[model samples]
Target chain A: MTDVPESSRTLPKNSGIQEIRLGFTLQHWCLWQSKETPFGEFWPGGEVLPYNGGRADVSFFPMMQSRRLSPLARAVSAVAWHSRQQCGDIPSVFLSSHGESQYYFEILQGMAGGEGVSPSRFSLCVHNAIAGLSSIHNASYQPYLSLAGGTEGMFAAFLEAGGILLETSKVLVVWYEQALPDAYQAYLATSETTFALSMILTRGGGPGHQLRLARRPGKGGSNAEDCTTSLVQTILEGRRSAVCHLEQSIWQWSLDDA
Target chain B: MKNLEAELKQLIIDTLELEGVNPKDIASDAPLFSGGLGLDSIDALELGVALKKKYHIHIDTNSAELANYFASIKTLAGFVVSQQNKSTL
Candidate 1:
């Protein structure tokens, strides 16, 4: 991958907003229910409702090679399964906080016990496992990124994906997280065990879609919520989801819903 | 045997992140894979690693007797204790 400086690359002037279709949203959790199943029951009670009037065709159990697959890999599988219906080729953005937390925990435990950490776990501990998995699954071999931004991981990923869509024509953005074991959970303050959100964006005005960009005026205003929640609300409200800038407080609501 | 089974069940619950499951909920001699605990292959691999780490009992995946060992938490703990006794001897 070539390194391109953000400042050097000029964004296209006609980077007009386009209506990217909500293809599919897959969620996985460890719990079983008669009503539905997630990609894996890694996170129970997780919901993915799309506005375009489609059932969340979720999967319940993890894949066969799930032990080998990192959290990001599972997340990408959810996204890829949904994106198969639309165009196969597109830029992708992956986001996760405790990326490979289980592996990290194992490595730490090994080190504490005077046993060397596994080389395989060390090699895969980075934040990009999901992107690699997605690329392999789609056979796209396109440029993608894995991002970690603490509690704001999902929002940051959304912003980056939006930027990619603005630069290129369209992009697929996925956000996912796996619950850390209790020992690790005490180390990192996080809530909502596991969650994954995927959205496809294209440039060209279409029906029932919009994007907004703005800046935060000051603090002590509305508390921050993860981008996943916003996207879910948008879909639930029957409005197109929007991506807002990280520095700004922008809201993307469907005018039709209003 | 019942006490050992309960302890093994708790260990499985703690190790496998089987949220909402308790030692009291699991029955001794119940099948751990499909019928009892509903654990998958990944869970087996993880359990294998955990067993080795905690009990210092190495499980040969290729062993035909491996299924008997992992039949249930009760069986697994008994296997571990037996291995421990053999090592001491």
Candidate 2:
């Protein structure tokens, strides 16, 4: 029974359709994973999607600043920075299921070996580290939130992003997760390879795709893919919406392309 | 790899993941800490891990000379040479 933080648990239950003004795939879609079917196969239209993969280059971020990013953060950072580059400054959201479990793993290893923990690892261990670093690198003190919601983290983060969209015209959301190292393999599942998805969403696309979200207490959507990947598929295929049944509730994410 | 000084610079660049930074970019006399590379205590600790892993040399975590050893690329190589020599003997 992992006690979720009050901030995340207290998210507004308002259900509404959200608009994704822009769904961005990395210029480099290094989407490789060993979880039975590679995400590459489900590359949203299997190559017909308008947003194809490209090099996951971060020359945009200075090498000095990017040097310390974890694999998960690196991918998310690239997209986050890209979004900011395209939209100047705006509110941002970051969501991760485990939030740098490897950092925790390493710190524990140090403790067991009678060595002190690394400060860098400790600093980057928090769920908001990605968003925090993005804020620092961009010199933007704009509001941001980092949320952890297990399998539904991606959905929760986007929900918050939609909230931001209410106030601002756009919001940049970066969702990233990586396979836990070998030690955590027993304790955790979904230990797939690295995956990152970024989307710049806006409000009032006006008569485009109607987006809706509801928290009905039942199970229906049995999608096997991760939350973000499923969202990507939904956006790429122009689905009415994606309903992901998380641990405690079902999140119906609808995007009307019509 | 000929010059231990140059080799240590490469190692630092690789271990610390100084992206867009080359060995030549890191001055031998320049400080590697707060004043020079803008690296903090965390980066120093990571570099410490890299050194132990590569050279199998034990580092004195509390030695007074530790700061001097980590002061610059040249100083770090000198420390590595001493430690390596000590291990051989």
Candidate 3:
């Protein structure tokens, strides 16, 4: 079990969701996965509706820029670009458990083998490289954030999006993750399937469903990986609410039709 | 000399992963960076590394003539031949 930090324990539950007007609305979202059937396939839980295809389709970028994006970045760019098409440009919060881990692993391996690092590879190995590339490709100067919040990263991103909503009319939240390298696979538990999900969030009193997030104090048996898929399922299925029992706290999400 | 220039064109395409670009399409005398091919600084560095690894030649990073040598496939082939002769000497 993970130890709850004293500072975090003292922090109020829901992390100021109520203070930020309870919750935000789900304006528009795009979910892209890696290995779905052409006709669309559902997970066993049957909560998430099938996606058309797992491909991201980032041909909008020029070859010079598109060629530089790693496979995961390609997915992220696809969803981010698609979600922002109607809205033009807006600030974004990017979340992932491990960003470009495969690329980082290759860089390390190159060094270990006495081969000098490729300058291009080194430049894109950072956690926020994709975010930076997306901004440059789109020519959008709107502020953006990249975060790796461990097991609660998805939930934490929502809280951050809510905070952004307080200041702006809309915020885009992009969540993407690929499987870690086999070397790190021994311990880290992440989704085997590579996926990226982007959601454009708006403040309360919107036309869409009202998505509320709150926390219940206590530990329960829950895998953080499942929480992410379940959260997406809860939204897509138009289910009322879903509770995720995490190691440190029980995170709950409720969606009310608006 | 012509064969070396052709080889250099293929090397550049392979090293930079310039998909859909063919060696035959690369003009021997055309600029390789910024203006003609539109490659940026990172591609320059990456190409430098690839050249060093393949030709077993040292690149003087601060040399005044470095940019001229990398300016075009024709110039790059000339530099490679010169370096090969010097190594044999």
Pick the lDDT winner. 3
Encode model 2's per-residue lDDT on A1-258: one tens digit a residue. Answer: 112232343235545633223222222122222132323333221222122243245566777787788767766766677667666787877777787888888888888997756566788887788889888888887898887755455667656866786687767777777767797777556536565666656664443333444554544444323565556444444344445665555665443343
The digit string of per-residue lDDT tens for model 1 on A111-134 reads 998864444466568778657766
Compared with the true structure, all predictions reach lDDT values of 0.54, 0.64, 0.76
Rank the candidate models, highest lDDT first. Answer: 3, 2, 1
**lDDT score, residue B59, model 1?**
71
Candidate 3 on A1-258: residue-level lDDT in tens? Answer: 122332343226455343222477877777777775343332211122234365567778888888877778888888888887857789999988788999889989989998878888888988889999988887998999999866564787887887888889999888888888999888877677777888888997788867766665666787666677665554444455566777766776665668
Instruction: Please list the residue runs of candidate 2 whose C-alpha ends up more than 4 Å from where it truly belongs after superposition.
Output: A1-55, A106-122, A150-152, A165-169, A182-193, A204-209, A219-225, B1-4, B20-25, B34-38, B52-67, B78-89
Model 1 alpha-carbon miss at residue A153, Å: 4.1
Tens digits of per-residue lDDT, candidate 2, B1-89, equal 23888887888777777777888888888999977888878788888877887788999999998999999888898899899999999
Tell me, by DockQ, which candidate is best.
3
| DockQ score of each predicted structure, in the order shown | 0.07, 0.50, 0.69
Model 3 chain A poorest 10 in a row by lDDT: A40-49
Deviation of model 1 at A241, angstroms: 8.5
Candidate 2 chain B minimal-lDDT segment of 10 residues? B1-10
Tell me which of candidates 2 and 3 scores higher on lDDT.
3
